[model samples]
Target: MDSSEQQDNLTESSGCAQAALFGPFQLIMKDGAEVLISNRRARAMLAMLCLAPDEPIDRDHLSRLLWPGRFEAQAKASLRQCLSDLGKLLAAADCDLLDISRSRIGLKAGAVRTDLSDLHDLLTEGKYLEATERLVSIGAIPLLDQMNYGEAFDDWLSVHRQQAEQRLQSAVSVALSALEKGDNLSEYARLSSLWSVRHPPAQTIADRKQGKVRIAVLPFKSIADPADHGFFADGVVDELITSLGQVPQLLVAGRTSSFQFKDSDKPPSKIADTLNVSHLLEGTIYRQGEQVRVAVSLVDAESGFESWAYCYDGSLDDMFAARAEVVQAITNGLSDALKLTEHASQPRKLTSDRKAYGLYLQGRALTIRAIGDGVLPTAIELLEKALEIDPEFAECWTALAEAEINMTVFTPCLDRLERCEKAAGYAKKALCLSPQQAHARIVLAFYAWTQNDIIGALDLAFEAYRLEPNNPDVLNRVGSFLLYCGRSRDALPYIEASIDQDPVNGRNYAILSGVHLNLGNIEAAVEAGQRMVDLGFPSLWLAAALAVSGDREAAIETYQLTKKLMNTVIYPPAGSAPLNPDAMDAYWLMAAKGLWSGKDQDRKNYCMVLEMLHATLHDPCDSTIVLPAIWMGEAPMVFKTLGTQITTANFFAFMSLWTNAEPINRVRLHPDFMDFVERIGMVAAWEKYGWPDLLPKPSTII
Candidate 1:
């Protein structure tokens, strides 16, 4: 055969296989001709198998997913028919796509290529910009578009997409950071240039002449053997950060961001620019026999000058005392250099036992990373072990509480109410151990919010923020709560402060996006949302913000791609327990319809669902159900819920939503609302926070 004919034959033998589910479920093949399958179930089955290429899915699980409401026998029979049809379809297309057996099924290894697989590969290779471009190009493709497979499948797809988006987002962030530092410039120039010009990062500390004193404490260098003294070196940096973070006027970079430069050969000036810190602290630790030696210095970001230097020598047994001494010296030096009063010359010690303190530091580090899904239990174990070593360790208790709350709120692997109860217990114990513990206060604030004690929650959140002004965790928590409660303007400064302290943190960007969205700063919100995606903390807020900001086409596209995942989790199918479906529904309506434009019937249906959820579940607060009820014109249901809330001292919490003008203002005319509001001290809160403009003028006392 001629060369042209041979090339054609080779092309025909390399049968094309296409699979994508980000928007629509699309699967096809071509051997010089396109292959089409008419059966929807067959197509869905192929997609499912292809989604987990090379991993065998049990027949029972596949049956349940494909026929959620069917009996086992009937479901398995249906699955068999689908598999047979899919096998024949692939064979006709000249593709070897399935590996089916009596007990298991999966896509044939190396025989198929999928968008999902390609996206995952890009993320794994750290090609964030490429991954992002691929995702954007997919443009709101729904997972298995419009397929009625069942809620089981829906729920799985939701989590699957969420995870994928998170990976892509993380890649974006790392890529952007790399670009900023002149790494892989030519390779990622397109993404870097586009993102840099379109969504410039928050101004770095080097760009700002005046603000809170920003600082980064670099991980200490270890001169001793790697295994024995490595933890000691880390412990010192962690301790110093904790001690420095107590100063209200200072902004301390989080360990995760600062420690990224451990053993880095980059100059101090370069490190400062990368970390966005005006000042840097460098240190070294060396342990030999019974003696421990430490050396440290502070550097000025702009001048690249060493401002101060210190060395400490002490017995390894006296490490805690020596640490206290060193901390006092650093704080004094920093206070002098910054022209600010030192909050305390000596930082408060967490634990007197050096071994216990080391364990606590280890646990603390783990908990910081525990914010990611499925990682909380590990942190919880470590924190609990640390507490066991020193039961009176108030900080350990607080850490445990924080981890429990994260597991409950951020992950769906645990019983939420149970986790909440455990979190409250830990927080209370921490408070009892040390009444001034800021983290415990924040945990209690979360408990208060859950219980519908909005007034108490806000009070606690503010108290925690005030106590630990430089603590990024507390700053973000307070800011997030304020934003959620319709105090976006008030929340902005706190959120910005957190970003200043932890500029590279994905969580900080996420909060910034929410704050911007709440303030109706569309461009800022979009930029922040994109930054979050870049940072690999994918969330649905960006799409909602775009929708609310009048970018209908983009919003709809994003929504279509994410709706299944959003819906599965927000409006969970029967038999699954979501943390708070009522709240999720309220959030969904707000995100999808600008919080103010749901159809009357849609609102009513959601209100009904909310009522059912409230009745069936242990809802400590009325706020979740009340807003949706009010939004949907279900005045009677709202009033009834408020009545219960008032009786339970949750009235203040219900009134918390009253500060949100767009929805709350519209409900003031409900005859029963004003009477309930007066009885619940709404006037006092309004006086303090300023009244929502649409509230009725002061009328006759109820």
Candidate 2:
């Protein structure tokens, strides 16, 4: 046959040839014979083409990447020779897979199939279960294993490998979510365990099962008018959960999770199962005028049998004693029923005055809700009034600190550092009054983190955890601090545990999203972000997660929603104008810049608005202005900002420098990174508490 006829015949049979790039590189012919390409550059070029399948890659770009240091003419000449050799090799193997042109190169359409393409097809078809099974069977193997062409090629390979892993993880996340929605618990557990093997939690299953008693205290049903007594009932339940969490052997479900069942129709057994607890404590409260009555029962979750029961009647005037009696009775009953040692420590009352306690409860409720315009300020006012009535109310002080810390973010018009400093002061006062207040410690830890005191922040967070291991807020805070310090693997277990304990709290999910994003679980991050939004908390972090997940439209929508929420928070109807208009402008500008930085197609349109906003801001350090530059991978801008920060000893917005995002990773890869970390005390922090995952150990940092 002639050459053209032979080519036609080869083309007819080419569909049978396949490339496997998920692990080792393989080129299989029609007869399932492996055709070896011994040339390393040829193999890399083939892998690159296979990555994009039938899409064209610029010939110049390919040459530059593979022959990075060569002159343009020499590189192109080498590329042509490499292509000729590769073509001859493929022809010898009876495979015709290249679609070469003068300007571009790509794999021939329908000429080769890849394992990655097959996996993507399965994912596109929504065969998540099959995709997950296939991924598990494939295991945690790197793509194009042991192929290191050069620095440029290695960087390209690293990005592609990460993308591959992200795609697989996204499939797993989708499968898990589907299984959960379908109520397929057995399959969910099996799949979750398998996935967990690849990305292990900080605490192992054995560590979680170390002879601990798990219990959930449900919010008491109110028999009185809810509007008048709901906060009191919630307060009592909150206090009970807090007290129970202090027991050494107890693992109490968080108040947010327990309260999720306050109006639930689910039976106690089901609620207990959902909370992953062996026992459930539930009750009813009735109050009329100054009189109050409480009735409670503890049930075995598995058997659905009542293990203990109690009732108490007391005046509202003696609320502290009444609450104490209820807590003590439950603890004693639990000890007897479960054969556990009784905790001897008594619950500390926050305030002696009844009215002060009432006001504190109301304010705490509003603070926890954290929804509407002026809610935080109103909560602050009520809490301050409570403190006025009883200046030594430690819990009230902690609550005030929490509110102020929240205002640092939610109230854009306020001075950010001023709020943080105020929160620190309140936290300090609370610690002086009650040294064991974990909430106060958490607040102080957050403040310490803002000031870039990594050592002090971690110490305070660890102390808070030791004080109340099962407190969900404390767990989330500690996890957040760890994440900020670039200890994502160490942060994962705490964030997951916090979510398990407080599943309904949007804030917990928000932190979980950050942990997942830093760990490179894009789909899980987006899912967690969506959950936060579904729980009525629109977040810029959610928008960022969506953008990272490649859902640009959804990300833009979320960003718009966040702006609206911020507007409401800053310019509430009937509320005073912003105390600092520039601060407000700075806040909005930073958010806009973040959104703009993530968009490739929208940048041209967004540039004008960004410039306008930038022109309006007087403070150079305002709005975390360097963050957008970092996100855009502008190393010079980042270095310049850091230089100023280092000179002034003020590192505003440097908290996120340690994250594992690609932009931050690129910054870390810069030649000046070691010097930067040393100057910023990150090196010292790493030496004290181990190095971050992305950075090399001190000895290796030449």
Candidate 3:
């Protein structure tokens, strides 16, 4: 058991677990019921350094082993950050995990349990060969043994995949071994199969049902002779939907959600099945002069029981009142018969500007159905006219903001940021007037994000979600921000949640695409990217993901196709927020100062675009987002240039990425970058806007 003999035995051994003597440490459970476990690397690092006990591990060898594919200086800096984070996490647990100095890190012997020691103890217990085999089978040793090179990140990705596969293999082996050694395997297998059925087997998210309610507001047949007042029948259907929604204990189907079944040859049972409703409400409306008659009957979906029937007549002016009466009667019937809870509707004074509201609703109606030839333009014109008549209207402003935001997708702009800013302004105004407005808040956040103010956008998005927890747009923005933050794994759950809330929304499809890209999940990114493209938005960002996820050829092709589509199909002239390569003065400054690690042609084209963008950078404000920082070397280089000369005050201001200063971060930069120090000076900026985890600090110069 001498030290030298022990070390030799550990090194020569292979398979699962190997043991070497290490120090004793304490373990404490936190008040929050959370476990505080030492990271494998931290424990290993400590033990290695502790080999010389309380002395620093040689920085060079440490960096080489700990952070492969990273610059030595950069790796050293990250080790500092990792230690800092671990210190904070442990300090909260009242554990002093490390004491660090110029080049050393050491753990207090009593601070925490060393899992490495535990694994060793377990391996040394009786079945040494079996334990070693298990550790090797699990692949931790391979990960521990790796000493990666900077020029081979793709190889790192391979290592990551191999590590994952090895983990699965190890897990299966352990499970099988336990099965062989223990009993009652039948229950575990059955439970595992049952649990698996509760969720989708792939990346596709399955929608879960929330609160359920059963009631139907029967569709009313038109009594206005079918020839003249065709619009009146629609109005009656609309009024009923509005009135029924006032009841909280109801999932009343909207006219749009219901009318699809109209005139279809489908039977009532089939219609009910399609709507996913538990009851059917069918009725008719007839108008004779100033008076109108409406009839409705509720049919149970499951038992086929007749729930109730109702009829109403009222003068034209009291038409709305009559509709309200029908809603009240249905709720009263349900309460009296089924003993269900009744929700009271909150009363509000009708808006004073009824004429303007009418026009606005008309515009909204067009906008909601604003699909097909001439529909979008017609909706925009109507909304514009409504705004013209009542320029200060909050809802109208929000709607206008949405239309304009959508407009940028298909139309070219002199500057996308400028147009996006204008949309943001409108949304902000809408929020100012009605702070509880969900749609406006969602749009404002989206605007902030596109403009690269990620923290601001996320705050607004979360605020919007709080205002209307079920708001699909808010969830979509949250999902998008998660991806932007490089929490793609986290983003998937959020985006998937949005789809569950509003599966039919084309916008959610877009957010899902970005989440996939964030995970470096290339095929999934492509699938979701195609969905977004088919749903009619540019996939420039998606193309970038495709490029990095080892699909450079497809990415190049996607770029060519998207460019052609923007020119020929989407816009004929001034085809996009065109970046004119001819306009840049210092284009080669970027190319000459630094180089893109991408394909040479990509480098060439990107350098050309950077030239155009750089000329605009001289302006006090530039429309170019920091997206250039992501895709190529242009932005960081310019930021480097600005850092060298920009005034101290301006430099400080530019450091706040959350406060309308950070450039859009589209590319997740590689860590071996020269700008890490400057990027550190502007850390707040990148954290609030750039890829959060991948915030590669500018490298330290020797």
Best by TM-score: 2
Error of 3 at 196 (Å): 30
What is the per-residue lDDT of model 1 for residues 454-486, given as tens digits with 9 covering 90 to 100?
Answer: 556655776675456567777787666655444
In model 3, the runs with Cα more than 4 Å from the true position are 1-316, 320-341, 344-355, 366-381, 384-394, 407-410, 413-435, 446-453, 532-568, 572-599, 606-667, 670-702
Report, for every candidate in turn, its global Cα lDDT versus the true structure. Answer: 0.63, 0.69, 0.49
Score residue 550 of candidate 3 by CA lDDT.
Answer: 56
lDDT of 2 by residue, 107-191 (tens): 7788887667666666666676665565554432345655656898888877776666667568768877888999988777656
TM-score of each: 0.55, 0.63, 0.51
Candidate 3 Cα RMSD after full superposition onto the native fold (Å): 16.7
TM-score of structure candidate 1 = 0.55
Please tell me which predicted candidate would have the highest lDDT against the true structure: 2
- Candidate 3 minimal-lDDT segment of 10 residues: 655-664
lDDT of model 3 at position 686: 34
Q: What is the lDDT of residue 185 in candidate 1?
A: 62
Candidate 1 has its poorest 10 consecutive residues by lDDT at: 196-205
Clashing pairs in 2: none
